[model samples]
Target: MTIFRLPTAPRSLQKDQPIKFILDSEAIDCLAHNIALVHPVFDVQAFRQLALTDIAALGFMDRSAHIAAALKATLPAKFADATEVLINTLTPPNAHTERLGLGVFFYLPHTRFVAEYGRDHKHNAGEDPFDAAMRAQYELTRRFTAEFSIRPFLMHDFERTLKQLMQWLDDPDPHVRRLCSEGTRSRLPWGARIPQLIKDPTPTLPILDALKSDPSLYVRRSVANHVGDIAKDHPELAFDLCDRWLSHADKELKWVIRHAVRHPARQGNATAIALRKAAGGR
Candidate 1:
């Protein structure tokens, strides 16, 4: 196999210019190299053939989707089988980051591939495949945030998925805790909207409650964003939660409450305004 040298940076289209596409050839080269390292059986030639063809015409996300589709074609026939192969062969999170500044970029396509696979086959008889996809995503989160990938499961099986997310609140990994909140957001950017959450965020309150004073700033930030997302559709709920947390809140929890109410406060919500004022406009 001929080794493709990873470009140090994206090739500029002109002097002192940056490439518009995030998923450019440099990214693809890094991805192909890492995948080949992990899964020796991965069809590098086929993957490159599909990924590099019509390359200039595609944008960032389109390039990602194209690579995922190509992966489905080159990997196992069944989605479950292909997912299993990927799960067993994924490179460690730190390894990819050490080599490529955008380590998570390599896994984004895989995450999308699994999510697409689940969406297409979610209505299948047993829940086994969806369960497998969830487990794969959990592992993926250790390497890269799988916040977007987990949404399909939430949409497909809300009850079971929420139950699992609740359990993840106590996980040792802060990334897992963050995913619990981020994945369930009402309006996660670049992600599918959860209308049910937008209507009533009651189901997600328990998870947020557990994470309010989380040790990890990363988890706390997600909790804040999750609350902010709720505020957009349910200001009352957001304020109520903020009030509850703020009553005897520590500094960390206060930070979260402040962030959660920011959007509502900007929108001139009286309760949000009061809450912000009470927090000294922090």
Candidate 2:
């Protein structure tokens, strides 16, 4: 209920100072106020604004990870509607420059929140403001993390997350369905890549299988991208999926298959070439 004010600009100019820089200072303040009313504990505006500064400060002190862990422990849970808020709020593609810093402070933490709350205490029901705020934060965190750069980190948790997300493909919510694909994209640009999925795409097949027919463009785009990521290594497998799905005679499935197999087609791989021939391309 209380407004979480954005932090004052720093006295010294550092590399991280400009990471969260908004040309429209007043707009950032206004947005922060709005988020505060909906979920006060998610006072991330200051953190978002000062992300580079915090990390810079941490780096200078040789405590970046320590600071990150501390913030994770301290930051309040997000608002439930955070995803809706972010989807409707779009920044310019190149806005917010301290990419890695921004990725770590705002986006990475959100991924952890989703993995934690969305997977762990997801069903916990309560009217407590804190609980509501945490859930909201988790959702918003997830939506925001989608914009971060993900690298292939070999971890047991990646497998667990992929399995859980694959099941979410059946979720009725379009957003959750989209996350199922988007979260696992091999080359998700700014997202962490699931190495196992990239090296051996079998884990992602089920998620793609469930989402191939998804009506939401947002969800389908991710499904296409997930398959495309697979095609980077296993062109044959990607072509096989395209062959099977395209045979279904559904326009949407065709579209997804086309997008998914685009990379292989560009590479002139035999499977992709065959798919193109079968799809009536000369």
- The local lDDT score (0 to 100) that residue 51 gets in candidate 1 is 81
Per-prediction TM-score: 0.85, 0.59
- Candidate 1, residue 3: the lDDT equals 44
lDDT, each prediction: 0.77, 0.52
Q: After superposing candidate 1, which stretches have Cα over 4 Å from the reference?
A: 1-20, 94-101, 119-127
Show pairs that collide, candidate 1: none
Per-candidate clashes, comma-separated: 0, 13
RMSD of each: 4.1, 8.6
**Global local distance difference test of model 2:** 0.52
Q: Using alpha carbons, what is the TM-score of model 2?
A: 0.59
Q: 121-217, model 2: which lDDT tens digit per residue?
A: 3322333233332334325434344323222212334654455555556766566667667766776774556666677878678888888888777
